[model samples]
Target: MISEFRSFIAKGNVVDLAVGIIIGGAFTGIVNSLVNDVVMPFVGVIVGGIDFSNYFLPLTSAVTADTLEAARAQGAVFAYGKFITVIINFLILAWIIFLMVKGVNRIRAMEEKKPAEASPAPPPADVQLLTEIRDLLKTRA
Candidate 1:
């Protein structure tokens, strides 16, 4: 059972999955930063400085705390703006993944279409004769 577990862990699929999970986690951080630090700010400026992260509907009178975190701390609040930002992040990530998958598929298709290695041509007559001579000498020895 231990050997089987080791074999499973050593498999290419497991290694690839681990690597993918690590990379995906890192990618999430990058996407979050892109949305929160760059895109959202730019969008806010473009849309007359209306910050989406701060935009939320108060479900209760006590939820008037200006920011999502504060509103959540106070009372129930509909944090739709944060949801919108998350949706945008997901779209961007999905689009990038789609593009990457498409490129990989295209490369795979091209490779599949390429001609296979041609069989090596037979050695020249003189080389073949030399090889035969060498083999004969070895047999005689």
Candidate 2:
């Protein structure tokens, strides 16, 4: 049973899945940074310099702060703008992956649809001579 489990774990599909998961986790961090550090700042400037990370309403009795952490410490239950930002990051990553997969599929489809490009065959000598004879015969006729 242990050997069977080891074989299952060591199979190509399992290894590919593991690698994909590791790469996906790393890609998530990159996308998160891009969204938070790059895209959001430009968006904030466009939207009148508003920071979405602190865009939360205070409802707890200790309403003495304007930050999400302070609101959370005061037992607030508002949806975090950071969480929404992360969700958008995930969506954009998924879209990029989808577009890449679509392009690969299109290339594969075109490859399949095309006829195999074979090298042109050399003309046989007998056929070439016959062509000359035919041309001469036509001129004589």
lDDT by residue (tens digit), candidate 1, 14-87: 99999999999999999899889988888889989988887789998877687889999999888889888999
What TM-scores do the predictions have?
Answer: 0.75, 0.71
Candidate 1 — number of clashing residue pairs?
A: 0
Model 2 clashing residue pairs (backbone): none
Cα-lDDT of candidate 1: 0.92
Give the runs in model 2 whose Cα sits over 4 Å from its true position.
Answer: 113-141
* Residue 51, model 2, lDDT: 81
Candidate 2 clash figure, as a count:
0
